[model samples]
Target: MTDNEALASASNSAIAAAVARLAEASASGVPRPPVRDLIGRDDLAAAYAVQAALTERRLAAGARTTGRKIGLTSEAVQRQLGVDQPDFGVLFDDMAHTDGATVPAGSVLQPRVEAEVAFVLRAGLADGPLDTEQVRDAVGYGVAALEICGSRIADWDISLADTVADNASAGAYVLGTDRRTLAETEPADVVMSMSVNGTEVSTGTGAACLGDPLAAVAWLARTARAFGEPLRAGDVVLSGALGPMHPVSPGDTVTATLSGFGSVTVRFGTGEAA
Candidate 1:
């Protein structure tokens, strides 16, 4: 290999080690510095790969791989982050909360909420130039989703590299009960509403997700495939959120309702709001 390739490999391995340490610290409730503090370079893909490796390690250690989440899908968010598209992260079984479920705050750090659409994958999607229709066909069903994100890095001041190494800030998620089959609905045009403590917070459409949630998924699939890690069947895909993310605290009740997908509620207890 060339010198640059060797250096890149070393850098990727180092970043992956750091991420693994961070994940262990988070899971064990140990003290640590912000992720940004440790990110010494601007290689976004390597950093993201490290984050994915951390999640993969967790999965190997018995954390069930339940789903995947898309982040930075909105134009505004992308502009703010200086990214042209969205990022993806893994979701664990322990992080999946049912509708109306109450969770302790200690499980997550600086939890934030975003309303989104969830797709249950029916088959595997390999690396390629995937069209929107192919993404829709790969999707088995759609449901309302709430992505509960948390940052391991202090102050939540992170660049794309730092965020990538932090697993795209995916912490927890809640899913709506209503599941619509792909053939029965239009995933792109659905409307959604999010509220906190019974107060309406935001309104948006699925189109906000790179024109449609499936499109976002397709983008993620392509990206992952490029990295030699294609998505497979039974993986739940969380399309990017529709509106601004809402920070949450203990005692907060968040409800994200979709026009045809119904609603999902998450109640944060003092322990679950970490």
Candidate 2:
């Protein structure tokens, strides 16, 4: 075979291996070697390919796609990841929880929590450029949300490609009961405070999420469209974290409150049947 063919073969192998590792980690709740090590570092396209492949595998395995989650939209998170832009991942039906739900700690490895604004889209978004207003108009309502992020990479040691390939380090999410349309409230002015065990730990505003949470959602819609996956009606989009993320442990109760949007709570418990 020619050099080009050999390179393509090797790349395909890496993607397949990475997908297997992610599945193994998710099932076993164990960290795996970073995909950046298997594929070359800085190969985000390859990493996304791996993410898409694994997501498809998940869909085939009976997991239904619910929506998408945006990550690294905050400057702080981007700085931590050493990236200038944000990344995203698919959200499945099994990964969703309602407010006051109990999440099994054993189901995820190295889990953390971040407060966010979630949008329930009222209309399907086409594959193309979308502005913040268009995104806002498409939203049926917004809710206070907490993204439970987990990493399959050992000790959360990950590069851009590593996290991107690991389904954007997504675990599960909890959504608040109360919801409001954009006309009823300002998405950019909402303030979020996250508390663990009844003690406040992190705080931020909607502006922390790429200036406005709607903007992040717009970016996600456009980005997904570019990837051949358009945002559909009824899809819940978890706009990136409003501030820094905090670690959570079993028996811990985490709550996130958004100004004017009410609050959502999640309780963690020790190993339970998946």
Candidate 1's TM-score reads 0.88
lDDT by residue for model 1 over 1-274, one digit each (tens)? 2222233434544665667667776877653465544445466656665676676678788888876788999775566456665777888889988898887766888777889999998988884467677787788888998989887766666677666778888888888889999777787888888999999877788888898888899888887776666888898888898877878888999998888788889999965324
lDDT of 2 at 271: 69
lDDT of 2 by residue, 223-263 (tens): 88877788999999999988889999988999999997899
TM-score of each: 0.88, 0.93
| Most accurate candidate by lDDT | 2
Q: List the residue pairs that clash in candidate 1.
A: 104-271, 104-272, 105-271, 105-272, 105-273, 105-274, 106-271, 106-272, 108-274, 109-274
Off by over 4 Å in 2: 1-10, 272-274
Clashing residue pairs, backbone N/CA/C < 3 A, model 2: none
Whole-model lDDT values for every prediction? 0.78, 0.87
Model 1: how far is 196 from its true place, Å?
Answer: 0.6
Query: Cα lDDT of model 2 overall?
Result: 0.87
